[model samples]
Target: MDEKIVFKPIGYIKSPFEDVKNMPKSTRESMDVEAEMIINEEYLESMSSMEVGEEYMVLFHFHKSEGFKQRVPFMGNGPIKGLFSTHAPNRPNPIGVSTIRITEINGNVIKFNGVDMLNGTPVLDIKDIL
Candidate 1:
């Protein structure tokens, strides 16, 4: 089926990294960094089951990223590697997923660590790891 799939953002990320440059390579690399996921009011109920200290895989859009290349320099410095092999933001669908731990939850806001996304990044979904 040649149908297009659409998704609405459940929230937006508040991060320190306003630009892609100098950001950590992965969430694991930025465990010390703090961030916030401000869930839309309507989606607030969806996170009621979540608790502080839990880990969830957050899916988000690479809003600032553009198109992708089939081959790219690994880590922007290493030998050339296929796009899928690296965690580059550019992709056929500019979507990013990171497992982050909840540090605090207040009202519709979620404070977390392991931030690798840019400020104001659109969050698509959040899934429990276990």
Candidate 2:
């Protein structure tokens, strides 16, 4: 039988971006944006080996996105296409992944840049990418 897998959020992400419409479509060259991750107390120990100026892959869930359509209009374009092909927030799982630059680290909060998620988003995991 296939094994079952379960997961829980390790923390929550905070950002000035309160709405999806206000966020940019991409974070490639956007350096002015900023965000923070308020990690849970239980996961504090795991951060000991981490350091400043390192990058991490933040996996999070878009809790506010309720439903999804198979085909969505692309950036107000003409026809609808598969949701997976676009970065639309509406999805079956609504999981978002973004690589951000670590600006600073407090006791349980991490400040970073290149944020595409809205405030209050639950962070599933944080992995060192560099």
Lowest summed lDDT across 10 adjacent residues in model 2 is found at: 23-32
On residues 1-130, what C-alpha lDDT tens digit does candidate 2 reach at each position?
Answer: 5776566999998888888777766566445687899999999999887777887888989789889998998743547888878777788778888888888999999999888888899999988995
- Supply candidate 1's per-residue lDDT for 90: 94
What lDDT is reached at residue 108 by model 1? 96
For each candidate, the alpha-carbon lDDT, in order, equals 0.93, 0.82
Best by TM-score, which number?
1
N/CA/C clash count, model 2:
0
- lDDT leader: 1
lDDT of 1 by residue, 87-129 (tens): 8899999999999999999999999999999999999999999
What would the C-alpha RMSD of candidate 1 be, to one decimal place? Answer: 1.1
TM-score of each: 0.95, 0.83
The parts of candidate 1 lying over 4 Å away from their true place are none
